[model samples]
Target chain A: MYLLRRGDPTMFETFWRGPIGESATLVIPGYQTMSYFSDVGNLCWFLEPGFEREVRRLHSLVGNAAVEGYHVLVGTGSSQLFQAALYALALPTANAPVSVVSTTPFYSMYPPLTDFLNSGLYRWAGDANAFDGDDYIEVICSPNNPDGSIREAVLKSKSGKDIHDLAYYWPQYTPITHMLAHDIMLFTVSKCTGHAGTRIGWALVKDKEVAQKMSKFMEQSTIGVSKDAQLRAAKVLGAVTDGYEHQLAAAAGGDANLLFHYARRKMAHRWCALRAAVAASGIFSLPNEVAGFCTFTKDTVTSNPAFAWLRCEKQEVEDLESFLRENKIITRSGTKFGADQKVVRISMVDTDEAFGIFVNRLATIK
Target chain B: MYLLRRGDPTMFETFWRGPIGESATLVIPGYQTMSYFSDVGNLCWFLEPGFEREVRRLHSLVGNAAVEGYHVLVGTGSSQLFQAALYALALPTANAPVSVVSTTPFYSMYPPLTDFLNSGLYRWAGDANAFDGDDYIEVICSPNNPDGSIREAVLKSKSGKDIHDLAYYWPQYTPITHMLAHDIMLFTVSKCTGHAGTRIGWALVKDKEVAQKMSKFMEQSTIGVSKDAQLRAAKVLGAVTDGYEHQLAAAAGGDANLLFHYARRKMAHRWCALRAAVAASGIFSLPNEVAGFCTFTKDTVTSNPAFAWLRCEKQEVEDLESFLRENKIITRSGTKFGADQKVVRISMVDTDEAFGIFVNRLATIK
Candidate 1:
């Protein structure tokens, strides 16, 4: 019911909704991958070797992240990985819970999730820019959620650490401006290939101690991530790379089978449609468009974010989400993102039909 | 390295190590189940409808659990569901964290996992029998881990709650004593089908509000269980039911394709071998074997537990785990389960070769 009322990240469904043969299908026999330990010798004991290999291969192909020296740790999702990172960075012997801060208009779930357990190891300290504490863990979500702005860690305290949520750093959402080499970087198959139900996410950690600590947290929490999901994710990601390699071999400049190319085109079209609707409405405004030279794409490409941060121009429209709901649309209020209520975050990743209806409702809202 | 020194439940691998054709296989297409939401109308929005159906069907078939009028909430594993139950039962508005207790000789992972996050919501207070708190959560692991003792909640305080860990309460490990209708009963596919790597677990929650709270905790932790794993678990469980149905149609009483029958036979044989070895050794003792009339199998059968609670008879052998290590037979010390140091938990569910070697080593020990 909640999904019917709101648009989650189902936008990429349009591209892969139809039958595409066995390009990315996964087949598992009755007697395979039944053990809990995938690679016991590896630091992340539960991580499947095949999954790890595909993850590194995809990242290397996209040139989005540095995976050479990093240890890849799989989690149920980036959400689990985020908490694991916090657990890894927090000092167990500290007198007080370490403050976890992120910039305003951050991911709305961050605060609630961090404080959900009322954990003694860490607590949500909102707004990294406003955080005055010396001991803190700052999260930097590039091509940030809600606003689609590029970000970096604001607090540089000696005791402070950073967790880079690069969930949207893929070529379709944002340009691979550079190879991200951070202390801890997060990525997920949900945004990468729209396989949200797979619940497979990974982190590339620089420090072995932090990696082990995160893996320990995983062991304590979920035992480990699902091997079924990991194997499926590997297959899906492998298919994606196969598409690109196939295109490269043909040299036909046609991206009919390529996932990123197809997704990039769809996202670009949706962004254009949404921008036109917002401009024509005259009562709404969006963040100025940004572009960059993508190292992977080898071209200057416009940033097409997974979400649209829209602000109401009319003074009477204090709660934009409520206002949109009145117009038969739904959106998350910016208040949840630690921003003004007049601004709401609209997901641009809904199905093409849903996206069309949303834009039509927005254009006529005035 | 840790797994190398310990026997973790890998015994079921022998049954599933061979090709069983497509009986329990899972094939998923690239575009299938890409959305995060699965049966959003249900209390557990992330739960796949097919998975839920199979869970209920399997419970009815085994006559081991009451699934009607219950909300089945899935988790990463029973480990996650155990914590979820604790979270649901813990009063968030209370001034102090609720005490969590289990009987002595509890699952070894319970205490550390409960306290790992240093959660202010709940803390591990060992031994429910010794606990004197009015408001506490008691975990009852029937056909309990490490010791294989059938247990019941000892604490009946007015404000006390119970979470039944029925991971080993299956036809293979124990008889179908009754249809368990506890407030919250946890089970996992890892133990049920020996697909530990699938990492899928479910709880039959009796209360709506409690189920919702558990689902919320799941959302905050891992967002949701993996659809791929859930689908695979559903297929695997469905295959088990099919095996039994095939036998019923034939009316032959022969149980070749049935999973529980095969596993039960294997377990019973291993137990017989282990008992003979222990008796021959004359320096070790084991828990007395018990039996019950099983409704599922329609016969009185001897109890064959998944773990052997072995105690060294030698008074000088203070550390039994170290003693076993010297003999190249790895086992978990009873100290971890809050038991005497002279005893250790040996997994009876290992590969046939490994079990054969273990019993031989036991028989040779003075």
Candidate 2:
């Protein structure tokens, strides 16, 4: 019998196949324990009653009343939610041409995701100011990726609809009050909790109709989110809230200034280290280092150019990528981020040891 | 500030809002130790070198070939793979009228999923026998759900493009050797490994062009499957393969005869009990007692209604569902499975004690 190519079997028929008495089991024991339920992990839609109650209780700890009525839709991560939201809004309508707009040099995934969804149908329209409110949807990622720049826009949809994407409104980088109180907000646990593997995020939407439609689309697309991931996220969130409460109470009662003082001093030290490192690495340049990431350009002094703008030559970016792989360190070239070459992004979120190694590598590159 | 309607948030803009930090933190601890890689759990397109090696090893045990050159794609589940397949194949073309054909009472998810994809241009053609090769894609699920039936025609795509969806070719089931030789197959760990919560599934396609296009679609659709979920699946599959080897070794060493005899006796005893219970309960009539499920109909004897044939003008099935629920017995209504209202599916895989309880409850139904 000839062996078939991989991924060719029918799914609907395969699911009911009797337990293959094969020696190999396909899932880990812990995962197996939680696989039966629908909402146990970070990729969940339903919140435990207790978890929901606690979240409401801590509402005052974050932003203001602009968030009212906007409930959270958790996903595998914000990435999943981001793509889902884009698909939901891009449903074809004859009255207007559907377009996606975002700030230039925005999150790298946006254009690819848009292209993937749009295929050849719709195109990305950069610049929030250019939207005519007749045929476009705008995406705004604040405390943005790469540069960590936030753009405040009074965005309106083609049909005079107002939409907002407040993905990075966290207390760590900026004051909580600075959050854009728009109709929708997206956030992820990976960034705040430093649990990138969890792959969990949420969309806070104020409109019931849009939420229902999105839910339907999700159900039709990926079914509901993973139950196990959601439960785990809920448990983690509960623990953090408890920690925050304990810290706040201690501060209020004057029992310990150590907790707050240590946090402040640690932030100061990290910032100072980053500043000094940038200065020492003559090949790097950055506008500021206030947020999670810093964007840098090649200093032009090095014999090896930082980036080769490839769009003009009409060659794929992979050839340049091969050149970078020869070097020990890895950097995301500008093409992936939908930018012209002559620019590259470097992330400073690594651990002190790892960050030190990266800085050292950069220093030697020149 | 005015509160926006519940659903009208900016589609792509919601990611900026910080997640409910405390809630997310509560759920992270449970899955930290778990591996998230497995072909059956999610798509395998993003497998790392180490995990890829392991997956290949497991596939070799099953007598399947390694996935290379072709783009391996992952989905939220095998269900998503099914949707994606339909999307790719049903996209409009000049000669093709964009039609989908499936056997009657097919995998219940097909109709809903197809509609949900809403390629307004494509429509479902229910009769496979009359399917014209020109503009239609036929979906065939083997070891089919509801009725564990396999089809021969599904081995070849109607248009000769290639048969897709190979979910149930494991060792325990009657393998369709011809189908595996060339058709596209989709498989998931949900059934095989009982890890449904991870929501991972893979599709195998013989054609490289189809594979590449699907990969691009996946990247656009959900970026990629959850990395954490994929890793866990990989670990679990390794253990399962080991278990299969041990079982085979025991069988060969003449140490498993006693265990096999015990299992045979146990199955015989359960069937006997089930037969006795059915004789005692006149309200239901079963199609056959041998299959994975005992299908019931409301019309069995004169003046005795087999639950499968019992009809209500509006919502009598729901009434029956409530009646069963009051007994603390849970069984899916046929309506949910794309069957007639008079039919209800009763899984025979429950423990003998649970079956006894179910029998006792049925005795009380009349």
Candidate 3:
């Protein structure tokens, strides 16, 4: 069993622990909240007007990305959109399964989700840089998950299409260096607003036809995301964006900044604390921190990533996961992210108490 | 364009309409609802204790199905479960695309959803009975959508698996015929509680492995259904089951009867009114209504189908949908439901005002 299950609140709590109140929580009436679908667009079933408005509003408020000339498609979460991206990129008419690759030490779910059902449309061909392919789809997870490293499309080729998973690109997760303009970029409410329970995410697609196809895949797959969840997500986004638009924080009346500023502060604190704990542990190592000028935050800032990628230098800890498990520090094996056994990923987003316990345990590692 | 959108409330509005209140509405506490996943069982992310309890309670109270030995898997909606079923049923090792066949005049979305991605894992092979194949999957939509016909597995093959889409099998839509003990049976809150906006559905599977695979399909598909919607669904279901268990109607103490009884009365009235209008027209024909002794209601009950399947006898109507469109009586084209153009399906459960308009227009069909 994964070591995370031993805690009272557990390691999963580390992720998405920000405060959300009445402004974020939505109560849908028992009666019809809205029509099952959008009437004006080709999008089928329940693109709640409030949801669309708030999503567009949030993007504009952050100024981290551009929405114009793009088709915004909502999904169950970024995970489904990732699948939809694969479906949209894969040529249905092709005779052979399209090759799919990501960088080494990449996110693990990509390989399995890409190949599940052994669907003949796409196959997971590992290591984007190592592959000698003219025809393929490359996935680039920016401000990477296990490690807080910014990335760009690694396999630059004419025959390849890129799916940029900007899940970690929000100001809190990483420095929003510039407006992310890509063919397909994915964002999720779970990470940005800390409402993972809502299970809402969206893709900003440059090509309208590709966006339509991706939405069609959602229609065929789940008949679109839940209306209740969408409305709730809309409220959450609105709450965050309201801070910027209405300048709720500038009035200096509240204990917390707007959701964005609040997240930025909390993440910075945790990242700093985590770095100290690792520094205190001479046996462990983390990547050197880097910062970029974030247009949204208007400062040069480093990422406060969701997971801490740690590499063990000692031979006594051959498998970092086993070593962490023995120490009661829950973690995911680094190889799960396509790296070696010397490395493991630990959740830093856990409850502050849990993270303290995690850091204390790390500090004691002699 | 489809004819259904012409009505005041529209055709899509017919599916879910009920008087639900704050008791049924869910306010998801922003605190950790559960870990992003469950630590135990094959089910990964969510198994809301309330969701599973309420699902089984509702099913048992209605006496339409058995969940005693089944694994109840929740989904975003039955439409999503439909795709998951396709994924779980298709042989990953098979050399050829697994043929997925359903009866003619079937639910329209079946064929389109099956072929939407044009995935090589499964291909839509029309008409179950006509296709003589040992290697295929047959979908039996008991009290089928669009046409509202009660059906069974048309093709009995040792090599073929059956997916019983019982979306329309609720006491409101049809009689509680028997303990529907199918291997894989699907039910939805959209039909049962008239909350299509919630987008919650569950599958009761006899085989644990198949259930696990279906759940995995959900995990990889949408990363599980929305937790907020699931909690709300549990509340809706709990309310209905409470009415049934307490025998709300016997005491005459509640505002509404058990959801089943309330739906039964409303649907029967609409179906009777619809038949009278069709009879008055003299240019349209409808399938005869069949009744059976319902164990749950303990009476000989007739079907009050969610839709009215109409066949145009007059030669003037080359395409029945166009004729209806001209009359402002909205309907789905028969060809769209995998049938001939002469037939059309009308939503019987449209709003009182809209259904009245539909019946009035039908009376003038000559």
Candidate 4:
């Protein structure tokens, strides 16, 4: 059952509504994490050591990202970290603001978030593929948000900087191809453990100066992130890692009590249902399915993204989001992601009931 | 015993160290508050209803701020809310950035926080008293940060916007004279309940449009405040209010298990000790003590601010902070707060041990 409160029925749902059980849950005592400083000796003083340890352990367990020798700085979320990365990368002494670019069909928030302050430090420069600027910050979102495609940095300018948004790079969202060793990479518990409300994200920075600047930006922006959230995230991430460890000890039990396994299965099931719905509708199409050899799961797996990039084939559907809205469904417009109006991005991680309702509505659209 | 982590020895101390026992302790279950949305029906979509309810109740019980008609918007902290208020008040179409001015000897962070982004929407414009422009934003921190003096808006320009930072306005810091009905007033659990690590603050805004804009800024900046932190804040605030209610029923028993009463008594004792230390030092002077009749306490009370603004009377001590640093005590330089070099702001809310050490050091400074 969907435990939804009465409000905007059309509002997009988040992933954690499904039953993943109590292992990922956390209990924080009132007196815990009351001080602003978590580890005063660390460069990112606000970061809880336990959260950092869990983040490293999770990445190590999943074989997704390299954390060793990298500075771990916590943020409110990947959103704040994205801005912090921009702030850190931008040359303050420069005469003009640094241009920040991403590939088309980027996360809908990138543009507004970049340009919101009209900050002299950085400004949104659309489409990394079209940008020829030598000094620019390119965001590379792998297993990308809207399209769910594996990506690499498109801009190879010598003076260009890159901020790898690995928010969806976990084994559940995509294949664990290799240990990513980027200069700067962002991850969040929202996608990893479905704790979006925790507002916790961390960056693995290869450069100390950049990490310090990012930390400074956080200090200036919010006087650092919430320690309570960080503590909760630590507990949640620790539980997820523990589940994987338990699974490893019982390797023969294929779908044992593992968060990633459960999440991956759910995603796969959702994708199957969505594809079947679209085929039945005959008026909608989705991005081509991608699969790869898994390193962590030890089996070939089809990619199951957190979002379904759907394109309406009907010429009458001028605005897919509006058309869907008329049919008692809500979707983010492709135009928001710098794509054609005929396409809309549907979140695949919502509650099971919401997903079922969405698929049923889509199947009957014809 | 002080839990001093090995790090920067000169770093200033935070307040929550004294043993207040488990009354304010919160235990949050793991599965609770994982979504980004809290109260979708409210204008501030991310605000948890329980948090809002507790905030209103606390304000009503304390008679500090008028919250009846005001919109209570949650932020990562008052730091973020301060920026949000600035973002909300700044005119997008204005030819130049909105000038943000605080009085001389203001909070050390105000200037840097205001200008860090180099936002075209707002710029740090030194002291409000020196600012002659009609189009500006003025920040009023009552029972002010450095000097702990009761303050009013230094600039009364007809077009100027005011953001009342009432972070130190609680009964412990100062006497609650009346219910303050400001356009934008910011408060935080960091000061109110000694939960600096939670990074949770709420802004009581009178204007709907301004509140919405501030909320939008938060949405763009951090996506939203952490629900876990909000939940904890709600619990802490509720407990504080419960203590007051309990106190009223047991009025004959003074300082009876009330957080505010406990904090007030602690503050009173610390201030007395500090004053005695300064007098004994002969080379140091502190701001004049202020007192008023408190509506909540039902008695005349002296202001026991969170900070002791101390000035060095010794001619050799050009920099008071440096002088204190040599004495193995850390204090914020008055220069950072736009005051004279001889004046330094020392945090009075640190652990009893740290405060005791500080006072002893101060007394022997001569």
Please give each candidate's TM-score. 0.98, 0.66, 0.91, 0.95
- Model 4 Cα displacement at A340 (Å)? 1.1
Worst 10 residues of 4 chain A by lDDT: A4-13
For residues B1-366, write the lDDT of model 1, one tens digit per residue: 112233345776655554333678899988887888998688899999999999999999999999999999999989999999999999999999999999989989999878999999999999888898699999999999878889999998889999999999999999988999999999999888888889999999999999999999898899888999999999988888877887788876655577898899999999999999999999999988898999998999988888889999998999999988888888888999989899988888767787888888789899
Q: Rank the candidates by DockQ, best first.
A: 1, 4, 3, 2
Stretches of candidate 2 above 4 Å error? A1-68, A87-97, A119-125, A157-163, A235-285, A288-342, A350-366, B1-45, B48-74, B84-98, B119-127, B154-159, B162-182, B204-216, B231-366
**lDDT score at residue A249, model 4, on the 0-100 scale:** 83
Measured over the true interface residues after superposition, the C-alpha RMSD of each candidate is 1.5, 14.9, 4.0, 4.3
Is 2 or 3 the stronger prediction by lDDT? 3
What fnat does each of the candidate structures reach?
Answer: 0.82, 0.19, 0.47, 0.68
Best prediction by lDDT: 1
| Candidate 2 per-residue lDDT over residues B1-366, each given as its tens digit | 111111111210111112211111112223241222233333344443433555555565665433543345666778778766765665545433356666654555677666543344455656566666655677776645444455545424445343445554443332323324444677775544445566667776666666656665555566456655665555545544554466567655331222212223343454455456656655555544223311111112111000112222334444544445666755555565556655444544333455567666665554
Clashes of each: 3, 104, 4, 3
Lowest summed-lDDT stretch of 10 residues in model 3 chain B?
B6-15
Please compute DockQ, using alpha carbons, for every candidate against the native two-chain complex. Answer: 0.76, 0.15, 0.45, 0.55
True contacts kept of 4: 0.68
User: Candidate 2 residues A22-81, lDDT tens each?
Assistant: 111222233233333334342334333343444444344454224466765766667667
**Candidate 4, residue B183: how far the Cα is off, in Å:** 0.6
Error of 1 at A178 (Å): 0.9
Best by DockQ: 1
- lDDT score for residue B182 of model 3: 92
lDDT of 4 by residue, A236-271 (tens): 788778766776786756554577787788788889
Q: After aligning candidate 2 to the native by TM-score, how far in Å is the CA of B1 from where it should be?
A: 44
Question: Which 10-residue span in candidate 1 chain B carries the lowest summed lDDT?
Answer: B1-10
DockQ of 1: 0.76
